[model samples]
Structure formats: structure tokens, C-alpha cells
Target: MDKEFTPRIAAILCQWCSYTGADLAGTSRLQYPTSIIAMKVMCSSRVDPVLLLKAYLSGSDGVLLGGCHPGDCHYEVGNYHTRRRFAILKAVFDTLGLESARLKLSWISASEGPKFAQVANDYTEEIKKMGENPSKKKMFL
Candidate 1:
């Protein structure tokens, strides 16, 4: 791999939970990869399938969806909805020839700053190993 090759990751973080966790990671000065571009949403369930696909097509090497833990969502059932949606999204990604590893979902609470940093580091490395998004390359050419 080229030394300059850096993966591009699109991260959708639940505003009430994962986003707060990420902010904590930042304030705590935890080191993580800088490859991710994060967007905060009211709930993880709000991350539409099209949005994930579009992110890949637009050159993101991976997509990460972070939300509250299964039973602790601020909106009660929001994380549950996210879980179901991600399962379907995974199947869609498979059907579209996208590797399942390139799309990930995690439950990160507001108190899990270390976990957030670790996730960022780990996902960045995973995306780097996967290289670029082939579909994006083809579409761009």
C-alpha cells in the first residue's frame, strides 16, 4: 500500500449517545484515526439505506453507524429500529457486491469515550485494509 493511501470513512453518530461519546473522546485527547467524517443524527434509525449507498458511491471507503446501546436509547425504540434496519442494510450491501465488513454498526453510549476512540481506530484500519471503494472508482471514471 502507498504510504499516502488513507481510507475515507463516513460515520453517522446518534446525537444523544454516540455523538456525545465521540465528543468526549475528543476532549479526553484520545488518539484515533482522522479518516472519518462524522455526521450527527437525531437517531441512528434515521440513517437511510440510500445514504449509506450514496456515501460509498461518493468515495467513502466505509460507513459506520453508531448509536445508543440496545435498551438505552434516548428515544426508547430508536436503537431497536436501527438494529433491524442495519440487518436489512447488510443484506442490501451483500446484494450490491459490497463487502459486509465495509459497513458497520456499533452501540456506543455517552460514557464510552474510550470505546469510541478504539472503534474509530479499528474501523479506520479495517477500511484501509479494504482499500478504496471499487464502485466509486468505476463511477468516477
Candidate 2:
């Protein structure tokens, strides 16, 4: 474990809120880890469990799913759907011998730039302490 390990995170953000919040974090010059690679989708519910699995299998040490808060989604109940789906995804991860801690679900409003940055930093540190994803090594086999 002496080798340098930088955790790679796949962040899927809702365009209406989470993405905007992340963008605002950047515009505000907030400091967060560079390990996250964010992808914006129309809504949090649009993210499929398969997509999250793919990210993990493809060498991502962690996956962060960000969406609007419940009752505040632009698409009414989209965030609710996301919350349910995320739970199922976590179960699937656990069944597959993957650490469910590697997956994070966060609700961030468009105005919560500081919160987004803090989440990013915290999640990044957690992943660093967790080390690399074991699934990554198995992917090549």
C-alpha cells in the first residue's frame, strides 16, 4: 500500500440543481478534490443503476449521485425516484461484494455551492482512506 493512490470518483449530477451547485462551487473558487469526474443529466432519476455499476467496474474508486432535495425537484418527484433507485443500487453493490460506502447519494440545491464543495471534499477523503476499489483489479481478469 506504499504506492501513491489517488481515488477516482464518478459524479453524476442533476442538471437543474446538483450540477448548477457544482458549477457555482467552481465559480465561487471553492476548493475540492480534482479526483471527481462529473456528468450532468437532465434529472437524477435518469441515472440508471447499470450506469453506476459501469462506473465502478471501469476503475472509479467511488460514485457520487447528486440531485435536488425532495419536494424541491424541478420535475416534481424525480428526486424521489432517484432516492429509491440509489437504495437498490447500494443493495446490489453489497451483493456483489463491493463496498456500499463507495457509493454516495446527496441532495444539493442550486444555491448550495459550499455544501457541494464540502461533500466533494469529504467523500474524496473517505475514498482515499478506503483505498482503491477492489472491483478494478477484478475487471482486468
**Using lDDT as the measure, which candidate wins?**
2
How well is each residue in 1-141 modelled by candidate 2, as lDDT tens digits?
624778889999999999999999999999988988999999999999789878877878999999999999999999999898889989987897778898899999999999999999999999998998887778454
Q: Could you tell me the lDDT of residue 13 within candidate 1?
A: 99
What tens digits encode model 1's per-residue C-alpha lDDT throughout 40-127?
9999988886788677677788999999999999989988988888899889878867687888899999999999999999998877
C-alpha RMSD for every candidate: 1.5, 1.6
Candidate 1 has which clashing residue pairs, if any?
none
Model 2 poorest 10 in a row by lDDT: 132-141
lDDT of each: 0.88, 0.91
| Error at 88, model 2, angstroms | 0.9
